[model samples]
Target: MTALTKNNPFAASVYVYDEEEYARMQMLVTEDVTAGVALKGDEVVSVFAHQDGAHPGVAQSMLRQATALGGRRLDCFDTVLPKLYADAGFVPVARLTWNDDYAPDGWNYETYRRYNNGRPDVVFMAYDPSAVGSLYERGAGKYVTDYDDGIAKTQAYQAASVGN
Candidate 1:
């Protein structure tokens, strides 16, 4: 395991774990069995950061660490903040949806289901860590703002549909 620290109080630590260990750690955070399955070899690296640590600095740090470790790709299951991943050069490749019965704590499954008219959506993203530096240099702030806007929109939509 490798740890990256930032000055931000919210983002105290970001850890990049070896494939086998990462896989084991993921088991406790999610029901997705394939979280790091594609990153089993040395070509890809798996990373973890607390939801509160989902800031640009942490993301950039992780990207750099992954690149330094000789990772060709980086894979992670970001339950929220797809746009942040998008900014880091990660693209959404898959979406996993779960019913209310299986939804994780703090996730408003009913709202998500209502937004999709009964389909909840969770995003899985991938990216080449090597390309992230250039991407970040281009317009990192824009991506973070866009992600925040998306969250705000979702919250507004859900709040509006509270009693419907």
Candidate 2:
């Protein structure tokens, strides 16, 4: 529900959304989701953008600032957005379903993803706290790995670091 008019190292502008609007989007989709805008000083550097399509650019921009701000993880339905997150070096963790009766398909998961709408799919992705820098510096090894596989790869890396 937010839009980013500008974004850069120095400044950015982002449209803000209230809880009511947020709820409406969820109600229409009837899925678990969250989104917002980013700002640096008084400028709107980037808006979280839409979850529907072509979000790689926006997700990367959002990831840049979100990581800088110590963002833990983002939760959203399995949609184009998660792919953008994965492309940004984040990994998919687990898929979950909502128990509400109004939820279609009983919020059941499809293909290890809870957001697959049959027409279009959605997925949730998680990013490592340290993968915020330039992709090359961090190594695209992790980025290329699927969300599920990344968990094991990261664990191995952690173990190796500890062994050293």
Candidate 3:
């Protein structure tokens, strides 16, 4: 899993598993599984395809599995990730990207995205499923505010751009 996403700036942050879940998360995977979809609560933190000697669609397949497994939200940094998730019933909220003055963020070989600001973030896109209602419903769309959890917990917008 790390090998596929090593080029990502957030590679260090992708390790979102809590101690207990880390030991057992693999039990949830089956023989046919070939991709990695890291989750935090109901959100998917990371998705990586084992592109080394593997077939296409590994990442897409895992994303579908994530939704089926109850992922409610996720932040996608890959250029295509936004579109892929949009087609899967998710609604785009914030589209952030690093400024042109700075280099774009992405795997070394990837092309710079058209727009981005979500961190790791050369061009980040965050999505939430309509079923959960959107930030607009919660009155947060006005400012694209970070969640107000008030304590040691995950914030919606914070976790929405990157993993744990």
Candidate 4:
């Protein structure tokens, strides 16, 4: 039940590597804690999902969308959930001081970085479907169990389309 704001940035934007994914909408919002995704010039899709919503499916849904076109996309300015992202299908790209420069008006950068001695915490992750397998993929099931989303219907529709 938290409010979204620039200082409480809980969103992420990834740079898509594949041409196909780059053409698609580059943002996801599966929860209330997430902020609006800002599309930069090109190839860069930034989504802001606050850390508070990590336990829910906010980050997972966003990561799923980022890699939906085959996992050839990346750029996450994340300061949270490395293992969570790993289990969901993304690979760690780097761990470093947050390089995120985007902020909303009246946002204080100094206080934010002070959480880690004047450095914002962050880890970059990329989705590489070829390099890693998700937990659900290895679990016993024909499809990952996302009861809230109409995944079954979408799959059925695609399968039916292919048969035609």
- TM-scores for every candidate against the unseen true structure: 0.37, 0.39, 0.51, 0.41
What's the lDDT for all of these models?
Answer: 0.37, 0.39, 0.45, 0.41
Point out the worst 10-residue segment of candidate 4 by lDDT.
136-145
CA-RMSD of model 2: 12.5
Measured on C-alpha atoms, candidate 1 has an lDDT of: 0.37
Candidate structures ordered by lDDT, highest first: 3, 4, 2, 1
Winning model by lDDT: 3
Q: Over 4 Å off in model 1, which ranges? A: 1-56, 67-80, 106-120, 129-164
Winning candidate number (TM-score): 3
lDDT of 2 at 64: 53
Summarize candidate 3's per-residue lDDT along 116-163 as a digit string, tens digits: 333323222234444232222211122222322211122354464455
lDDT: the better of candidates 2 and 3: 3
Which stretches in model 2 have alpha-carbon errors above 4 Å?
A: 2-47, 50-56, 97-124, 129-164
Cα lDDT tens digits, model 2, 88-137, are 55555443443233233323334324233322222334456445342321
If both were scored by TM-score, which would come out higher, candidate 2 or candidate 4? 4
| lDDT accuracy of residue 108 in candidate 1 | 39
